[model samples]
Target: MLQHLLRLSYPTPADHLDPEDHFSTALGTIFSDDLANQHGDRDALITYLPSTYPAYPAVELRLADPAGEDERRKFAHYLWNAGVLMAELWWLGREEEHKWRVKGHAVLELGAGVGLAGIMSVLAGAEEVVISDYPAPEILQNLRSNVERNVPSQLRPKVRVEGHTWGDVTSPFPAANAGKFSRILAADCLWMPHEHANLARSMRHFLSPDEDARVLVIAGFHTGRARMAAFFDVVGDEGLEVEEMFEMDAEGKRREWRSERDGGAEDHGERKKWLVLARLKRKTSINSGSA
Candidate 1:
């Protein structure tokens, strides 16, 4: 069954208008013990699922240093995203199912900004999880640090961090890893419309050939519906079929998000950002014949 997972709205810090700063301040307060007192740009610790997993323990994440005024990396310091959080919650909710899906399987995460989804996958019992992003030294280094700090020692061996750029199929690492992943995850990666084809090519190259192998994608609607639709179109051209798609509103309402059109009447207010989630699988000859 298709499920739309919604993120609960919380009050933002009024002092910081930047979403990243607001998130950092709010998270620091929530996970005070993990916050360091260093004054300069340093890592901040945030807790995930503090209430529910108190015994097993809330996951501690050491995020990358916040972007400075002249920071060249535009997307690295943005530690939090509604879609990624929603995807994490969805996986946590279906713990047993996810464990079954990932157990003894290879998993890969693209555009793993803070490594949350990939970290969660490792914790959920994936045989191996490769977390990847743009090949910026700072971004890659921070990603490695997060995986090292948060993931238990026993599971750390199963997680690896790599530097990957979209559309580089000829690269040695990607060429070697081609069709090797049973599961692929991408959260908030469709914001850039120009990168749609490149992202789709990467997905095609990495996605395993098995019928059950799948890719899970989640994105916020802030980038506009047209751009999101274009991404799906490119993915379709790359031979992936959307098995299920849905949207979740701030009120936790779940509704089907059809792939047929660009715009809808869905509210995009400050508190009403919609999350679009989809499960995709390779299109087989039989499925293509039917289409």
Candidate 2:
């Protein structure tokens, strides 16, 4: 892990994907500017063990639908701050003001670490929700544990834990599932530039072809703003473009998305506090410069 002074108010989980030779059992504690915005939980101290994850979503916000995690031996490697933030977006928005809607929609969570956002979808009234990650027995097992523990028995039938490799065809998710999800959630999954093409392809594969179908994307700038930019470009190549996008600071202030930004790759302190969120849709003839 990157060695830095972790002056944590509350833990924001870190999305560490790279396999490491020497790994520590340290559960990263992060600042919760997001928690403060959604609820008054900024000062809550986080306590996480090797087996469990951090940032209790219930400490501050109340669920729209009361919903209700287990991995004992293995450390959760993919749970990150963006996943929590995504969950917050779905769960925290006031009923009258929520633009990020999941209720009564088919939802998919890509690279769903700990399946936080997907669980929130279940709680928020998604008609059906699929929480998927890389096809690993332990990871899928952990995801199942989280979903079963959180979602109510009545709502349990609405959620499915599936092991999925992105950009795959007709293996994990059946052919019937193509273009099935109206809302696809991707948080902190764009850290790898090399996988950008595959990620874009998968988004194109699963996203609904309808005008209302949308993909929700969020990623931290800790993985360089350039990588995030490259992801947009690749998605465009796959016929998906951002209908709306913006940069948000750790303080919850939002800004316009720009191609250029200072200190995104250099200034460590400022960049770590920055992330981008976007809504994507399939390109149409109207958006393809029909004149």
Candidate 3:
């Protein structure tokens, strides 16, 4: 018998919503520790059953060793804190004034490793959702499988999985998706300082020109807050402004975003617990880039 990942477990109820869709974010996570997780990965077809989401089905991920610097590293193997934070925020999303959600919006998830945010967006009743990542065959295949199995069938039409390399304007992805996404979600994607400009350019490319359009970002402190700051520098260069930014711990304690703590006294444990969540919008004012 073959293990087929199916959406049979996630059914649409008569109320036009899911049973646990609007459950609650007060608890921060569905599963205990690391925001709840599942497991499975091994041989033949060597299909991986990487169960990152507690509420969703396992995705089939096949790892391929790359030759160039383009494939130097891969972060899709595990579900990080920032990814979990975004998912939990969108779970119920009633804790704050600016609730994390995608209802009635065209959502585009950048660097969608394992497609967690976009998958949750579909459950949150988004108008449409496009889950994207590097134009890697193995990665894109896994994204498609996850979307097919985790998202409700009726809403599958509203979701698209595409191969998108950040800032690659020379390619067709940018032109096709330009100004189409009302809400762009990026989680744990600001780590590489070298890629900040490219990432920012991609955000500008897909982000809708509408006043209400915004980019939702959540990055962990594990990689150093300085890298996060560098990403914002590029965001400004790309005509984007930080509407709001804050840090929240795994235990759900919210705080204002600030400079990184001293490196010498840094606590790896504490760093693992903190995540910076921010909202970015296009700078529309005449003197938008003055800062």
Candidate 4:
């Protein structure tokens, strides 16, 4: 197990120390072993055990062949968004303020791909989780296979898989589901500036009416800052407000992207990868009585 951990580029310091040093060390060992011998002909199984929720079983997923031409170009199997999603889940488990967002709430994940975020939500005790992606037959099949393989039989009833295209507010998700989801998730779906409007429209249509309802969005810097900024602009124009945002590097170092207090200077270029996470809520309007 330790050898597999080394091969996977895990932090070296974690290996030498005892599990008592940190909970994640023990969890990482378990996952390293599970994934060591799982890579097969067309798929690979990756495992994750969030340190915050030790009681919950490690999340195991069988990823489709990324070498497929359509799969590679469509960005369906990349690991960037999944990494950020896992970190956010760990953070939520420890933070009292945001922990309740998943438990007993109606959750929706857009561009679900292999359904990592949505699957994690179910493990976190979400009342219901809806996973959606493009209507391509191969994509939907791969996604359904993943949910069936990972989610336990008992919990499978709480999950729903569907085909959805961004910007189309009518199909797949019916009128009855509108304003029903308390938490919506979008990961690594902001690379295309052209699709920003459609993404926002879907969020606006489905997000719950409660003021506290939120949409959790994350994306990597691989697409560049300009595209990310454009996505923010479109969402705002579509009536969503950013409540919090931050950037995290490969080492788990986080810096406030838009906060009252400045996050100290650091060289972002040195990091091979960086992710930005944001929480958004519907923009509220107030009507004033005539004076």
Positional deviation of 97 in candidate 4, in angstroms?
4.5
* Model 3 agreement with the true structure over 1-291: per-residue lDDT tens digits: 011221212133435544343442112344334332211221112222223344444433332333355553756544555765676673324576354557899999998877777887887688999998888877788778777767768888999988888878667767777788889999989989888888888887788887688899988877766766678777888878898888887666878877667754667656656878889988776242221
Query: Evaluated with lDDT, which candidate comes out highest?
Result: 3
- Compare the candidates by TM-score and give the number of the best one: 1
lDDT of each: 0.66, 0.64, 0.68, 0.66
Every model's TM-score? 0.76, 0.72, 0.75, 0.75
- Candidate 4 residue pairs in clash (backbone atoms < 3 Å): none
lDDT ranking from best candidate downward: 3, 1, 4, 2
TM-score of 3: 0.75
Alpha-carbon error at 146 in model 2, in Å? 0.5
Model 1, 1-291: lDDT tens digits are 111121222244444356674564455457543321111123345555522354434455554653454333446555445434433544334643552266577999998877877887787778999999887777788889878878899888899999899999888889899888988888878878888888888887888887678887877666567667678877777777778777764344667785433346544443125667778888764243221
lDDT at 243 for candidate 3? 89
